[model samples]
Target chain A: MILPPPEPQTRRQLLRGAAARTASAALAAAAAPGAGGVAPASAAVAVPAASATIDRLQRLVRVELLLEYCYRQVLSSTILRPDARRAIAPFEGHVEAHVAALEARLAARGATLPPGPASVSQANRFLARRRVGGRLGHLRGDQDALRLLLSMEQVVIGAHFVALLKLSEPALVELSAQIMATGAQHDAVLRLLLPPHKLGSAAPYGLVQGVQ
Target chain B: MVGDGGGASRRALLGAAAVAGLALSGCGATAAPASTRPAPAVAERDLALLLAALELERRTVAAYVAGLPLLPRALRGTVQQFLSEELEHTGELISLVRSVGGRVPARPNSFQLGHPSDAAGVLALVHELESAQIATYLSTIPQLSPGPVRAAVASILTVDAQHVSLIRLQQGQAPVPSAFVTGAE
Candidate 1:
C-alpha cells in the first residue's frame, strides 16, 4: 500500500506539541521516586522552564525572519529616496544580526531553525496574523514605505517585549531586551525620516510598548 | 490480619518520609542561601533593583529640567517632550517600587546638572544621561524576575534607546550607529 504525504504543520502546532512533550516528561520524572524516595524540585520545575524558554526563543526567531524578509523587499524597491536608502540599509544588517543571535540560541537548545517567508503569499500570511496584512503592496511612495517599516519595527519590538515576559533564562532575557532596543531605534529613526520631520515625533512616549 | 497489613504499610510510609526529609536537607546544604535565591515571587533583590531604577529616573528628570534652558530654541520643544515622558517613567517606576513593598527614596532637592553653555553641551549631556539610563535598564531586566515588572523595564529601555538615537541625530552624528544597543557608547 502507498502512504500519503504528511500534513503541513503550523508553527503554533509544533510549539504546542513540544510543550506537551516537555510537560509529560516532567510529570514522569516527578512521579518516579529517586534513590532517596523523593523527586528533586529541579526535576519538576527545571525541565518545563527550559522548554518554555526554548519555545519563546523559537517564536522570536520566526519574528526576526519575517522582519528580514520585509527588510530585504524594501531595500530592493525604488520607493525609498537616496538619503532614505542610505539610512535604512543599516537596518537590514541589524535584522540579520538579530536572526544570527536568535538562531544560535535555538541551536544551543537543540531546536530546529524556523524558515522565513519564501514567497509573497507566505509574507502576507505572516502579516495577517499580526493584523497588518497586505501592507507590502501598499507602499506606493517613500512615505508609505517608511510608515510600513515603522509599523513593522513596532511589531518587532512588541514581539521581543512579550518574549521577555516568558523567557526564564537570564541570558535570553538580556539578549531579547538588547534586540528590542534596536527595534525602537529603528522606529524612531523612521519617524524622523517621515514627513513633518520633527524630533518630538521620534519618541512620542516614554514607554516603548510598540504599536500593539 | 487487616490490622497487621495496615501496620506494615504505615511503617513503609514512615520510612519513605524519613528518606525524603534527609534528601531535602542534603540538597539545602549544597544549594545557595535563601537570601540570594531567585524565586518566582517578588524578592528583596527585585525591590532593590526597582529602587535603583527609580533613582536614576529621578536624576534624569532633574537633569532635563535644569538643562532645558541651555538648549537652542529650535530643540527646546523636543527636549521638553522627552522631559515629560521621563516624568511619566518616574511615576510608573515609583508605583512599581511601592507595589513590591520597597521604600521609595525621596527625590533630591536639586541635581548638580553641569553648566552647559550652549545647545551642543546640553545635547551631549542629555545623550550621556539617556545612555546611562538605557544601561541601567539593560542590566536590571535580566536580574528582575520574569513578570510584568521585567516587561515594563524592557519597554522603558527601548524608549531610552530611542532617545539616544534622536540625540545623536541632533548632534550631527549617525543615528543608530550599532545593530545592538548594549548601552555602550
Candidate 2:
C-alpha cells in the first residue's frame, strides 16, 4: 500500500497558523458593525492581475540573478581588499539563496524560471549606464563595488515593497518582506564601510521610503 | 473596524470563511478571482491592521526602552537608534490611523518587558521582539488594501528586519541567521 505524505513541517504549519489568526482577527473586525473607528469591511480589496504578478516576479528573479553575478565578480576581483572580500561572502551567499528560493516558488506555481544569468542582460545594461563618470561599472575598486551593490540593494528593496503591496498570498508577501529586510541590512552595512565624507549620518531617515 | 462584543464567535466565523476561500483559490494562487467591478473606495481592513500594528509598535518602543539600560554602553547607541525608528514608525502609523477616522489608542507610560541581566539577555529580548514585529507585518500586509499604505508598512518591516540583523551581528551571530525569516510564528 502507498504511504501518505508526511505532515507539513513545523515552521510552515506555524506560518499557516499565524496567517489564519491574522486573517480571522482582521476580517472579524471588518465584519463587525459600528466597531470603533474602523471603516466598514466593505467589498473585497483588489490584487494585482495574475499575469502582472507573474511578470513582476519574473523581473525580480532576473534582477536578483544579475546581483548574484555582480557579487561573485566583486568577490573574485583582485582589486577588492581581503577584508572586503571576506565581508561580502555572506551577502553573496544570501543572494544565491534568494535566487534559489524565488526559483523554487515560481516552479511550484507551474511558471517558467527564466534561464540563468543571461536573462539579466537588461539589468547589466542598466548598471552600465549607471556607472559614475566614465569608469567601468563592474570593474571598479572596493568602494565602487560597494556603491554598485548599494544601488542594487535599493532597487531590490523597492521592488519587494511594490510586490508586497500587490501580492494577495500571505506567504509571498511574507517572503518578499523578509528579503527586503535583508536587503536593507546589506545596504546599511555597505554604507558603513564607505568613508564618512562620502556617507552622511548612519540611519539617515526615521522611515525608509520606497518607490511610490 | 474594531469590535467589542462577541469577538470570539465573529472570529470563528471569519476564520472558517478564510479557510474555505483559501481552498477555492487553489494551492498556489494568492488572490481572489478577478472582477471587472471597481475595488472598494475605502479600505476598512487596512485601517484595522494599521491600528493593531500601531499598538505593537508602541509596545516595541517600550521594550527597547526597558532593554536599553541592560545593554552595554557600546550597544546602547544601537538600541537608541532602534527606539527612534520605532517612534518614527509610530508617528507614521498614527497618520494612517487618523486618515481612516480611527482614534489613536492610548499608550501606557510603561509597557511590561521582562528583566534581562546581561548583554546577551538584552540582545535576546530585542531579537524576540523584532521577530514578532516582522511576523506581524508579514501577515498583515497581505490583508491590507493594495496601495502606498501597504508599501509604507513593507518599508517599515524592512527596517525592523535590519535592526534584528544588527542585533544578531552584535551578538556574534550571522547577520542573516535564516534563509527565510518568517514561518517562525
Candidate 3:
C-alpha cells in the first residue's frame, strides 16, 4: 500500500525489457513438442506486477468494503418495503461470507486482520447517511425510492472501474477488471428495475473502461 | 519512513482483513489487523477517503445481492454479476487498507439508511450511491498518493463515469452526459 514511487522512466524501457522476455517465451513455445499457437505454449505471460496478481487481490478486498458501505446506506434510507428487505437478505448473507473469506486471505499474507462480524452493522449505518443524491447524472422517476437505489449502484460500478485503472499492480487490475465487469451487469439489472428514463443511465456514466 | 502525509487511515487498518475474507468467498463476489512489523506510511487523507470508498462498495454489494431476488428473473443474472464485481473490488480494498496499516470497518447488520422492497426504489438507491462513488473518487484523486494510488483513484473514477452512463441509459435518459461529477476533481 505504501510503495515508494519508482523513478519515472520512458515506456520504451519497459517495452525493451518485455521484448526480450517475449522473444524467449516465443522460442520456448515453438520448441515445445506438439505446442500450437492456438494453445500458445508459454502463453501465460508476465503482466506488469501492478496489473498482475497481488494488487488485483488487494483491490478486490477494498472494493468489497465500498459496496458493503453503499448497501448499508441504501438499506437504512427506508425507501423500500418489507418484501424488498426480504430480497435483500441474500446480499447480507453474501457480505458476511465475503468478510470471512477476505479475512482468511489477509491472514495468509501476513497482513493485519480487520474487524469481523462484530462490526458489520456499523458499516451498514455508514451507508445509511452517505447519500450521493444531489450529485452526478441525477435522474428522476415516478418512484422516488427506486431512483435512489439505482443512483447508489451507479456510483459503485464507477468506483470499481477507477480502481482497475489506477492500480499499477497487474494482479489488482485483473481483479478490478473482474469487479468492473460485475458492476456492468449490476448496472444493467438496476436499469431494468428503474423507470424508463432512468433505465440506461448507467451507460455513459456507468461504464468502467468497458470492462464489461 | 512513515510520514503524516503517509500514515494509513482508521478504516484502512480495520477493513483489509475483513474485506479479504469476503472477497475471496465471492457473494458470487465481494479489513485490517496490526502486525509485528511497522505499517506503511499512506497519507491519512487518502486513507480516510479510500476507506469511505471501500465501505461504500461493501454496502453496494450487499444491496445488489439482497435486491436480486426481489427483481424478476430477467434482472437476476445482471444482479448476480454486479454482486460478483463488487466482491472483487472489496477484496482489493482490504489489501490496500492493511498494506497502509490502517483500521477499517467490519460487516454491519443494517445500514443507517433503510432498504427498499420495490424494484424502482432499489434502482433509485443504486443510482444515488453510484453518483456518490464517482464524485468521491474524483474529489480524492488529487490529494491521494503521488503514484499508483492516485492512478487507482482515477481508475475508480473512470468506473464511476461508466456507471453513470449506464444508469442514465437504463433510466431512459437519452444522451447520457459525457461526465457525472464534472467539477468533482
Candidate 4:
C-alpha cells in the first residue's frame, strides 16, 4: 500500500539534523520510525549502483513500460473524462519516443532493446501494486486521477535523475538529463495541482540526490 | 521538515522539494514563502547551463499555469499544483543562476511546436523540450565536480520525471515509454 510520507518536519527539527555528523546519522534520526518519526534513508529503496550497464538498462526499460501501461490504462479505462483523453494522448507519443530512442541507442551498442510497453504484457501486474487500490485501479474522480499521476511523476523524476547518475556514457548521461528535464516540467504541473497537506515538507520529497 | 535555518542550510533544497511533490494532491495549504532574492549575474558557463535549465523550467511553469486556467474546474487542482511545483523549481533555478553570477533571461522560449493545435504539435514540443533539457544536464553534469553542483543537477534531474508524468497523463500516455533509464558512470 502507498502509505503517507512521514510527518512534516518542523523547522527546529530540521535544524537539529543539520548539526548532525554524517548522512547516515542524520537520516537515521530523521526517520526514527514511530509516531512523528521519519522513515530512515535505509528504508527507502537505495539506488542500486552495483549492476552493469546492460542490467541497468534492462531494469529501466521495465519501469518505463510499466509507467506507460499505467497511463494508458488510466486513460482508456472509465477513470478519466473523455475530454481528458486528449491531454493524455501526447504522453503515449512521448513514451514512444523514449522507447524508440533507447532502442536505437541500444542497437548501436549491439544490445537489442527490450520490447516496448506495448509488447510487455505483465505491465498491469507491476503497476497494480502501485495503484491506489492495489489493483488495475480506477480513479474515483479527476482528483484521484490527478493524484495517481502525481505519485507516478515522483517515480519518473527519480528514474531519469538516477539514470543520469548511474549511466557510464557521458553522452547518454546528457541524454538522460534531457529526458529528465522533460520529466521535471511534467512534475511541476502535477505539484501545482496538489493540496497543502500532500506536498511533503522537504526539498526533494521525490528522490535522494546522493552527495559527493 | 525544514528548520528556520532552512534558508541557510544545504537541506533547504530538500525542504522545498517536498512542497514541489505535494502541489499536486490539493495539499500544502501553507507553503512558507521563500524570502525573495533578486537574480544576479553568473559565470558564463554557469549562466548557459542555468539559463538552459531555467528556460526549460519556465516553459513548463508557463505551460501548466496557462493550461490549468484553461482546464475545467473539476480538473483545476491537478494543473494548478503542477504549475506551483514548477514555480518552486523556477525559484531554485533562479537562485542557482544568480548565486553563480548568471542572469536569468527575461522570457522563456516557446513550448509550442509551431502552431497551438493538434496532438503532433504537443508531442513535437514535448520531444524538443525533453531533448533540450536532457542535453542541458548532459553537457553540464560531466563538467561539474563531485559536489554541490553535481548534487544540484542530480536533484533537478529527478524532478524532470514528475514533469514527464503530467505530460503523459494528459493524453492517456504512460509515465515512461522506454526501458533504458540508467547511466553507469
Per-model tally of clashing residue pairs: 0, 0, 201, 81
Residue A125 Cα positional deviation in candidate 3, in Å, after optimal superposition? 54
Off by over 4 Å in 2: A1-48, A108-110, A115-124, A129-138, A196-202, A210-212, B1-42, B183-185
* Candidate 4, residue A84: how far the Cα is off, in Å: 2.4
DockQ of 3: 0.06
Summarize candidate 4's per-residue lDDT along A1-212 as a digit string, tens digits.
99999899943244334333344554566677562464446644432432355565655555555656666777667766555555455665565455455544544433434553453235545555445232345357755775666566556656665565467555666555555554544444444444542322212333333211
lDDT of 4: 0.49
TM-score of each: 0.78, 0.69, 0.39, 0.45
Best by lDDT: 1
Classify candidate 1 by CAPRI docking class: medium
lDDT (10s digit) by residue, model 2, range A69-175? 77776676686767766766788878878877776666554455664454335556755553422122444677877777777777777778777657766667667
Q: For every candidate, what is the interface RMSD in angstroms?
A: 0.8, 2.7, 12.8, 6.4
Q: Give per-residue lDDT, candidate 4, residue A69.
A: 66
What's the distance in Å from true for residue B36, model 4?
18
lDDT of each residue in A1-212, candidate 1, tens digit only? 98899799964455546655665665676576673545567766776877787788878888888888888888888879999999889999899889878877766555667878888678878888887534676678888888878878888898898887788678888899999999999999999899788999889876887755
Candidate 4 positional error at B81, Å: 11
Interface RMSD of 4: 6.4
Highest DockQ: give the candidate number: 1
Computed on C-alphas against the true complex, the DockQ of each candidate is 0.57, 0.29, 0.06, 0.14
